[model samples]
Target chain A: MAKRSTVIAITVAAAVVIVGAVGAGVAVLGSRDTGGAAGAKGDTTVTVRVWDEQVASAYEQSFQAFEDKNPDIDVKLTVVPWADYWTKLRTDVAGKSAADIFWVNNSYFADYADNGDLLDIDKTLGSDAKSAWAPSVVKQFTRNGSLWGVPQLSDAGIAVYYNKALLKDAGIDPASLENLTWSPDASADTFVPVLQKLTKDAAGHTADDADFDPASVTQYGYNAGNDLQAIYINYIGSNGGTYQDGDRFTFANPKTVEAFQYLVDLMNTYHVAPSAADTNQNGDFSRDQFIQGKMALFQSGLYNLKNVADGADFDWGVASIPAGPEGRVSVTNGIVAAGNAATEHPEATKKVLEWMGSAEGNEFVGASGAAVPAVTDAQPVYRSYWENQGVDTSKFFDVLKNGTIPAPQGANFGAAFGAYGPILEDVFAGRVPVAEGLQKAQDAANAALDG
Target chain B: MKWTRTLLVYLVLLTGAALTLAPFVLSVMTAFKTPEQFARRSSLSWPDPVTLENFGVLLTGRTEFGRAIVITVLAALLLVAGQLLFSIMAAYAFARMRFPGRDALFWVYLSTLMIPAIVLVIPLYLMMAQLGLRNTFWGLVLPFAFASPYATFLLREYFRGIPQDLVDAARLDGANALDVLVEVVVPLSRPIIATVTLITVVSQWNSFLWPRVITTGNDWRPITVATASLQSQYNGNWTLVMAATTLAVVPLLALFLVFQKQIVRSIAITGFK
Candidate 1:
């Protein structure tokens, strides 16, 4: 009986202790005002979260200037890493504890906007602010005629960046090269022949010469083995293939098939490009090969320009991508500044968005040389910055003006993109025909869309 | 012949050690390299001009690295304490005590071990939300802190191996069950406890997925989350990332170095030899 009483007493004590610990934890958490910013009136401090640390330093300086002009309001900057940014933002939104403002990517903008996770800034900004950005960028941030986010920086896919000295050493004139006239279909017929002429084996036999050993060529003509969006999108777009038709993905069209076949022919039949096995051995993202002067051509974006410019000992130049049947086409992509719908400081958040959408903010992004400013007005400023740094930024503008195409956008596009990499590997490896690989991609894309 | 055999064994052991430590050694070397050196050189080679800029960046209060360290350490501590206390008590009961249907109850508890952790996530998350524990340290620690069936079972087996005479003598000297557990059984079970503690510390310290899913912000984000973030941000800046990774893993290495003797003894006592 005494032991039973003792057991009962111990149980009660444990229960009390557990309850006390829980109560104390709750009290401590509750005492802090998580909603303090919500109740602030008039001029308030707005926090903007971004993922690009390199660009954030420039943005903070620009925001300081904005604060100088508009002393009534203050801005706070929160920088999250690119990888954790989306996951963190999603969780914060779900918990109703998100930052006042944040950055969004084109890949995620549609999902975020469609799900009503973003604030509708169209009513706040009006037509003047809408007209400041490119039409394609405007289209990306708009869902059901409501603007969800403001475009900050934009990029376009272009041809392999080449070392000027290498080209000159091979007696190739950069000025005489028709950058805009060549097409992916023309790659097998004309471009590969030219590349063959330029490529020389260590034994002093040009790739085009009789008895030239294709297997023993030390350097390749081009780097066609890269991310599909980086190389294939240009081909697909130029051949009149659409990434999405209304709500469904349609990359299985004949145009897309032709483009895929053209890319494969560059490796297998023409032998102008490196073998898939060779590229795999080097590593998937081998842009550094060109910068290090190992390869003559490297496929990438203007974002790489800064890295190459800083790292390369040799002179390099960006050129317009080769034209295709439809016209010169390059995939357009950008980052957007958005607000979390669940943020407590809605008015302050809107003010922050207004500042990010302003000319000053655009100038800051441009001058930093981190990315091309999304605003049309600030393009020249970014161009001047790159030119001052001894890079030819003219090709970027040429791509924007005459070579740009809308990047792929669709429901569950992220999921579809995840399936594309493996399918591309199969195509490159010769295990599957282009048609079979594309059909698989389309089916996977459509399935993801349904989900 | 014996010398030859020893030489072969040494060669194999050295090869295994090199294979195991290669990635870690590479990370340490890369962490000290400048971005230019990293981009130009092979990932295996030492830096031409080594620098601590990466460590400086990580240790700065402006970045999430410092906060991540504090969160990881605190979570590990809470997890270790909770797991040990509950597991010891429950294990003691299963090994020493008699009750109606005790074997049946113990079996039912052990059966939970078969259920995968992923399958329990959604239901457990819902429970946490319902209890208003989401985004809290308690939320990160509590669900996982309880006596795991595997852990409890292991401890129970170890406890059962303890000589019952010591417990019986304490009980005869007018000591209660709790007293016997604290005074006699616990002292005899030190080696097993150390083994369990080491296992718990390592597992809890390296836990990524659950803490990642539970925590909402940098306020509770752990070292793994920080490491992942660093990897993504500096995808091109491998030098900085390798430095951060090396720093993040050093504590575990240090813990192993300090407690290796105790750990080996515990392993022997637990019949894991």
Candidate 2:
């Protein structure tokens, strides 16, 4: 009976609480039927969606200028995390509840465009926009003779971010770091000697010393983790390995296999890098380790420039990715904004999309040092922004001008990677031999690509 | 020997408690430290000078967490109350009232618990969108504001355990079914009701996926969604995230404290874990 009565009291309290809250919510949120379409025109609220908060702040500034000039359309920017962005986007696009204009990279834009869920930018902006944008970015979005997305920003691909102080302690010149090169043959070379000089064992012996113990090394010479964008893509590309031949995956290239072996050997044999067992779990672990001054040559892209700048206690500077056997290679990638096909206001959305494609808009993203804007004229702002931050970003553009390979291009690349990403991790961790692991990975990827 | 056994039990219990509480304690401590301090010191080290900069950022309208908290509270209260009220009424009918095919209907409803919540996400999203409720406050709360089959099943089992003679006395006194339910059944079923209320509250409060999918902007975003946004927006800065989480969880902790006696009574009566 006591139990029942206490339960009764709790239930009554629950009722009172709910009723009180509902009443308060009605008063605060406005008692109304919000059943009509969302983002409908009172004065035209054009919802613009992005994944980066820092980048979204830039968009907000850009949109402010846009609104000030237009005075008709009110733009609201929504920033979803990178993890949830695709999942929410698929549903939103499917349900016709997506933002009027939203960010979509080349890898993802295909599915949306193929499904007719995105508005073709060519129809909105015409050919005038294409010539002004970076050719690779413009080409990335163009499918079936139609441009699906307006190029917003591009990544200045894989470059070595060496801690200058760490290099100085190792008695290596910061200017001379660019000469390091890797070979698939695993024989002692310039890169190996460099790593040996930089890598020190717990007993204060360099890797060059025969007594140096791989087990007790306190700091790593390099950060060779399983980052698809920064580490392997640059390795495979610089080694002249091709993963995709148009629409299908073909990682069976010997150069690709050799490149995988070298990466795995960096951790397992030479012990120049951190093992995959630790770093592979979190994509950001290697980056975090590098930023904490625990690692020497961190070969990542311009995306991590801000993280390194804000976090590092020591002086650091960028150098071109190490020259591989086939000269240096970098993988440049771009982000684009796609307008929703089912958006209610087509004219307003086109105007918004056009603004996003314009230099006036993308320059805000560049000037903020958030991204290397894809609008050809806006690239200078990005470079100057980084230059002000005490890092020369000219190499980022040099790589673009020199041989920057675009990331694997295809409609089925996501599916292919989904099938083989984990298997490649085993290869990196040295649980599976690189040769055998990649053979299996190639089979799995080809099967997925076929589907 | 007895003292040693007591010591062993305490040691084990304390170790288990420490394991559970360590993460939470670390989060709170981290929340009070600056970025420079956090980066320099070990995670276990105490903050030399505690600062609420993270809390200041989260609560000072930079994240719209205050709005999210109010929305979450409203959603939870409404969901819990609705679930309890409807569950009680349904359980009464299932337990005492002789309705045709009641068992079959109740079994069918109970069987729905087998399906995963994810299977319902896309369909539920489409259904809500068709009703034009997506991004609205109603959409955030509507999916949860009903009797759960699990709650109803639990209540029905508890309701059946009540003595028929007591119900008969009220019925013989010219009390209608509604009067007997309101006056007799509910009063004696407080423990089960309290248990159900707690379950409903916790489940609704922690609901992340559905609310995340439904709401676009912060207008109808709940605490869980808001907390997740902090992780990505702030680049996994644990201090700021911990502050947001600490703010989000305090209300639930307060709710738990307020109903301490009722929860204890319910546990004793129902033997619920």
Candidate 3:
């Protein structure tokens, strides 16, 4: 009986696998009737992929407008979360199942462009289409003497979002906050003094007071931490130093080292900013503090604009990031949409891609205050939408015009960033000296780039 | 002296239980909170105005939380049924059948358990894509609905432990293999079968990575995939996340409640808990 039962179980298990496989095969046959790659199969449906849910609604509206205009062509937009976007896209591209049109960031596009996974924009749109958009954005997507994507939106500057009530209680002028300047030498710098003035102990003494206790700071004066984009990147570039020289990290530069040291000193020496422990443990520590009214000024990208706008109960305003010895040079980055080279319906995909690059399509996103559209003409609507929300978002644009630097970008940038990010954490945490950390980081970045 | 030892054991068990159940308790509490209430209050606090707005949003949102629940339940059912059927057959063959590679094949099959799923995803995904199974219902359930080594190993051992005298007695009565299996061995292996069924159901219900990778469209996306997508980088929508998490967990909790006796019986009989 036992032997017989074992045989029956084995037979049953094998039968189930066989049946499952056969079922899958039957489904495959049915799927083949839908044509290849998209909507209704043989009928013309173009798949478009994007990563941001905050802007997905706007894209859906934009795609609807496109579909209305081009009734023959159906567009399907899928929003992959930011975390899974690149991984899914990479696998899809490898499998030749990528969307007809999808987003391509500067750091990631080079591999696709190099491997001929992306459709050439120059071939699709021509010289006239290229010249109409922002010059820098056009330059960004241009790879191997051919443009690979159309820039949808650009994010370049970091503005200080200050709690109005915090500044008010600190007796600090909002106007003075805009031009606050930092230098390697504390006595020569104006930024540290402003931070010192804003910071207060539980015993009612400001950081400027000799009797002030660092242990019981009720409100932090500033958020200076390991955030490369909003904090250290601005400091590095604004101090006449650059984080990256082309593809290789150049933070070991004398001025770059000075910038890092002075910034680290704000936390360790002056005791104005939060410790590396707090910042290192939580990515959103500063933003949370600012919204909770524990922070005076939070310098960050417009990516957090919606979160701050919706979350804050206190009155808030935006000001340009503090200047260094040279000037306020915030790093700007852009998001672009690329057409898949391996798409089955090239002509249909091209038409969809063209619409994505058009101001008419981008206008939906801009008008809804989804993001700052790359099409210069559509930007006003985006600004006005935020203004209508009773928040002046013009500070980002204002700071963009003030000697801005491009965010670090190159073929091996993604790899290099993964290597150096943790190495610098030690420097920020005071475990490693800035000079030694920068040196080790430079080597690591170059090694990753070599690969 | 005996009471002291009992008290110590109770203390240890209570602590372990609290530690294990704390996250779920927090999730349930947060699910009832408004976004502002969640952010402002302590994690341990009761919701001042208990609301179901988060649940309402998830259920009605474009992701279609209701559809995900239905899909997950269907997949879990299919998976458990198929897995048990296949695992039992394979285990029975290995234990009692006289195939040439019986021992060799069993060892080989067992070795695959040591291989990581990550190493297999690419090739398996390619195979599924070639089979045109991606985004289909079967794609979500079929890859996982077969005889796993662990399942086969467990059942094979239980089958071997069945008495040879019982088999001889059944055969003496002119019982065929199928009749003997259905009437005798299957009845004797109830505890092990129940245990396998529970494990299969739980694993299938909570399966995330496979569903996320396989299903591009939400037509076949399970609740785990849907729950994960709710989390954005910037918006700390903890209340909404907790609601989705609580919703994902409720089915498993209900399943446990329904099968509590069988599960306990299986554990006691197997003596493997």
Candidate 4:
């Protein structure tokens, strides 16, 4: 009797397993057949992939407008979060299953263009491609005399975002911020003194005070750290130094070393900025501090405009970045929407791409205040939208009249960035001298590129 | 002296438990906070006015988190069912059935556990694309629906430990191999089976990388991918992120509550804890 019961139990378990597997298999396979047959029914789907969800939402409206104009073409927008966007795009492109249209930054597109994964914009759109978009944006996307993508969004210029209350309390005129200048030597440098005045200890003593405490700063005076776009790159450019010369690191230049020394001094010697130990690991540290009302002057670009506007409780205003000996030269970067070379529905894809390049279609982005549209005519819409919000955005566009220090260029920028990131962190932490760190970083960057 | 040792053990365990559960506690607290409160107050502070706005936005607004939850649950259920079924058959065969190269084959398959899932993503992605399965429900679940080496090895080890006498006695009663397996081996292996089911379901529920890579748009995206998309580079949206995490974790927590006894029993029986 016990044997029979044991046999029954084993058989029951085996039966459950068999039934579960078979049921699941049948269900999934049945659904897959329907799923497989669900494609290519009515309209030709031209998918557009982008990383920014905010921009994706804006493009949804823009694409809706495009769909209405072109009735037969259906546009689908895929928002891959920024972290995995590049990895997924690379994999999808390798498998020849990438989107009909995809957004590419300057750093990552050169490789795709070189690999022939992107369509030639010159052949597809002709002379209007050059004439219609922002000159800086068009130049960044151009490689070997061929344009690879349609300009979608441009980060106009790096600017300083200041908490107005902090400056007022420090007895520093906000207008003086617009023209503040810094040099390698402290004799003629006006920027450091303002930072010292703005920075305060817990006891309400400023950084210049003899009684001020360095270890317990209540408010940071500036954001000077390892950030390439908003901090060092702008500093390097305004000091008559270059970050990369045709895809090679050139920070070993005397001017670049001077900029690095000044920035390091702000954090270490002057005690006006956050410690490298904190800012080195957290990219959002300065921005978060500014939003939390702990920072006086936050140097960033148009990217953080919405963050500041929404997060800050106090009045804040924008000013141009402090000038170095050479003047304020901002590093401007732009994103372009590239057409896939292997897309099956090329004609429909071209139509959608053309519509994105048009002011009529791109204006939705500006209207929503998502980003500054790369199309020159649509830019006014972005400006007006911000003006309505009681913010003057001209500081971003005004500095662009001074030529930009070109954004990082190179297919292997990711690998090169990985190579130099740790070494630069060591330099910022005061473990390595600026001159020696710059030389090692330059060598590492070149080696990564060569590989 | 014994009480001292017991106190020390409890102290260490309490610390470990607190460390493990601190993040979940924070997630739940932040999920109830308004964005303003979350931004202004200390992270450890209780919400002054506990609100469901973040949850409302996630479920009802453009987030599509509701649909993602449904898709994730369906995929997890299907994958769990298939995995258990196939794993059992393979495990039983290796443990009970006399076949040439059975042990050798089991070890060879088990060796794949050392290989990372990322290394196989490209090849697996290519295979799915070729099968016209990309962005489909099948693409999301197919790669993981079959027998996992970890599952098979686990069950096979447990099956081998079952009393051979019972199987022989069942066979003497004119029962077939399937009958013996179902009536004898399976009844005794319920704890291990429950453990496997819980593990497989939890892993499937929390899966991110494969779902992120395989699915595009909102059609077949899972909860993990959906929750990730709520926060962009410039905006952390901690409240919204915590709300989404809270939503994703509730079902798993409920599952654990329901199966708490079985899980504990499995650990005690297997000497794993």
How much lDDT does each candidate structure score?
Answer: 0.73, 0.80, 0.82, 0.87
Fraction of native contacts, model 3: 0.15
For model 2, state the Cα shift of residue A82 in Å. 1.4
> What interface-residue Cα RMSD does candidate 4 give after superposition?
4.8
Give the clash count for model 4. 11
**For model 3 chain B, where is the 10-residue window of minimal lDDT?**
B35-44
List candidate 1 stretches off by more than 4 Å: A1-49, A60-98, A156-159, A178-181, A184-189, A197-218, A274-284, B1-3, B130-134, B270-272
The full ranking of all candidates by DockQ, starting with the best, is: 4, 2, 1, 3
Please write out the lDDT profile of model 4 over residues A82-162, one tens digit for every residue: 877887888789878899999999998998999999999999988666698999999999998899999989999999999
True contacts kept of each: 0.21, 0.24, 0.15, 0.34
TM-score of chain A of each: 0.84, 0.91, 0.90, 0.92
Which tens-of-lDDT digit does each residue in A254-308 have in candidate 2? 8999888888888888888888887776766666667777788888888878777
For model 3, how does the per-residue alpha-carbon lDDT over A1-451 read when each residue is reduced to its tens digit? 5666676687678657756765564454346334334344345888888887767778888888887888778887777776678888888899888899899887788888889999888887775787656666777778779988988887747899998898998888898887688899768799888888888889988888999998888889889999877888889888898877766779899999999999899988888898898997577787777877878999998888887886788898998998888888887778889999889899999888888788888888777776888877777888889988998887887776767665777776778888988898899989999999999999998899899
Candidate 3 C-alpha lDDT tens digits along B15-100: 99999999999999999998766654456899879998999989987667887787777677677777887888888888776779
The number of the candidate with the highest lDDT is 4
State the displacement of the C-alpha of residue A66, model 2, in Å, after optimal TM-score superposition: 1.2
Tens digits of per-residue lDDT for model 2, B1-273: 999999999999999999999988988888898765665446678986899888887777447788788888778778877887788899899999997998999899999999999999888878889999988878887877888888999899988988999899988987777767877888888788888888788888889999988887566788898888876622576777788888877877898899998878767766655
Tell me the TM-score of each prediction against the true structure.
Answer: 0.87, 0.92, 0.91, 0.92
- The weakest ten consecutive residues by lDDT in model 2 chain B span B230-239
What would the per-residue lDDT of candidate 1 be over residues A1-451, giving only the tens digit for each residue?
4654575577557656654664565444433223234234465667677887667877878888877777666676766677667776766667665677888877777777887788877866675687888666887667687877888887745655777876787787766455434455454344566566556666857677887777876656677764555677777887777666765777688888888788788777666677777664344335666655656666667777777777777877766666677776788777788887877777767777877887767788888788788877877888888778877766655665664656766556677777666777778767789899888878877887777
User: How does chain A of candidate 1 score by TM-score against the true chain A?
Assistant: 0.84
